[model samples]
Target chain A: MQADYVNPIFKAANDVFNSMLQLEVSRGDLETNDNLVSTKEANISIGVTGDLNGSILFSFPEDMVLDIVEGMSGMEMKEIDTFVTSAMGELANIICGNALTTLNENNYNCDIVPPQVLIGKGQTVAMSTEQVLTINLETDIGEFDLNISIS
Target chain B: MIWKERYKIGVEEVDRQHKELFNRLNDFLQVVRSEEDMEKKAAEIEKTLNFMGEYVVVHFDSEEEIQREYNYPDYEEHRQTHERFKQEIMEFKQEFEADKCNEELVMEFSGKLLTWLIHHVAGADQKIGEYVDNN
Candidate 1:
């Protein structure tokens, strides 16, 4: 994907984290990884259709996931259960939806499907020739990765 | 308690409704997370779910009216977002009626509700505020 396409996703992530979770986020340089294996425990995959036909994968470590849920709900969560996973999926959905809005404003005209949450570690995602633009985001709660693979 | 002033979208009516929505969700979250028996928690969930079903429609209607008055460019898209959430809640209510004591479904619903509210109010609804300020 073009470098310009990545900006909207980054901006959306930053805005959501800052506004929703009240967390400031700093993103690292965007790098491409051909073989994308998620080392994090929680993965939320959001599918994009219309002008762009691919998926955006949000990978969060176990602690980061727990921290986010606790931050949003003001409760202590010790494990990645259905409640935690669903919250992560919805967060990913909101971020993707906002990014799509930005893309539409730029005349991209795309829509996002419901997010699917996968809970596990060391899961390898097969991209099948799609270039994955991975970016590491640092936050006070923890660190997470945004893997964008959209054409 | 989850309702923060930062979620205000600069519109009085919509902001009030948003706060109410957050309060209701926060109430539900509190009950769900409490150390209560399943029956007690289920009863509270049912009450909140019913209130959410009716109040959400009212809130969305008011917000949409404001969007139309401002000639908000994204009115249709924003309404669709509201509609999708309404549909999901409706489905959840149906499942809840069929199995009133399903703690798992209630937990999932609570989690999704909290996340969706925070993001929509702080992220999507903020754009409406920006548009009004700009125009």
Candidate 2:
């Protein structure tokens, strides 16, 4: 994928974290993975269509997900249940929608569909793209992975 | 679900509506999360849901009018997102009508609404204020 596609997503995540969650996001080393897998407690996949066609997978560890949810809603959540997963899905949805808006400004004409959320530790997700660029994001509360796969 | 000061978008009317949304949603969520049985709370939940459904439409319309008055460049896009959420609310109403207003649906709806409203107000709606500030 082009840096044009990837940069906006990272910027969106950083901006959303800063403004909404009051958390600062730092980028970790970039990595590439062949298949999309969920190694965390909360995982979300949002599909990109229009000019860009693929999906973005976000994986958040259990502790981090709880903290993030707490920060967003001020609710004390203990488990990765329906409410938690839905919140995660909306979080990813906002990040992807914000990124696509940036792309639209550059005339990329891209759009993101609603997110599909999964909770668990081990599951392989089917994606439309072959080479996935995984961006590890660190927040004070915890860490999560943003896997970008677009053609 | 507390509404933080950071969620305000600087526009008085819009911010007021957003805060009202936050307040109502917080109350609705509180009732939903209570220890009361689902059947006992169904009437209250349905009433709050209906009120929220109507309030959201009014809020969106008012906000959109402000966007137009400011000639906000992203008015179309912002309106599109509003339409999407309105559709979701409509679906929720349908589910209620279909008598599927169970704990699962209520939980999912409340969760999605909490995050969606915050992000929309703080992120997308902020851009409109930023646009006005810069221009």
lDDT of each: 0.83, 0.84
Q: What TM-score would each prediction reach against the true structure?
A: 0.85, 0.87
Candidate 1 DockQ category? Answer: medium
Q: Provide a comma-separated list of chain B TM-scores, one per candidate.
A: 0.94, 0.94
| lDDT string, candidate 1, B36-130, tens digits | 88777788888877876788899999999988999999999999999999999989889988988777888888788889878788878999999
Interface root-mean-square deviation, candidate 1: 1.3
Candidate 2 interface CA RMSD, Å: 1.4
Name the TM-score of candidate 2: 0.87
Q: What lDDT score goes with residue B134 in model 2?
A: 77
Alpha-carbon runs more than 4 Å astray in model 2: A104-110, B68-73, B131-135
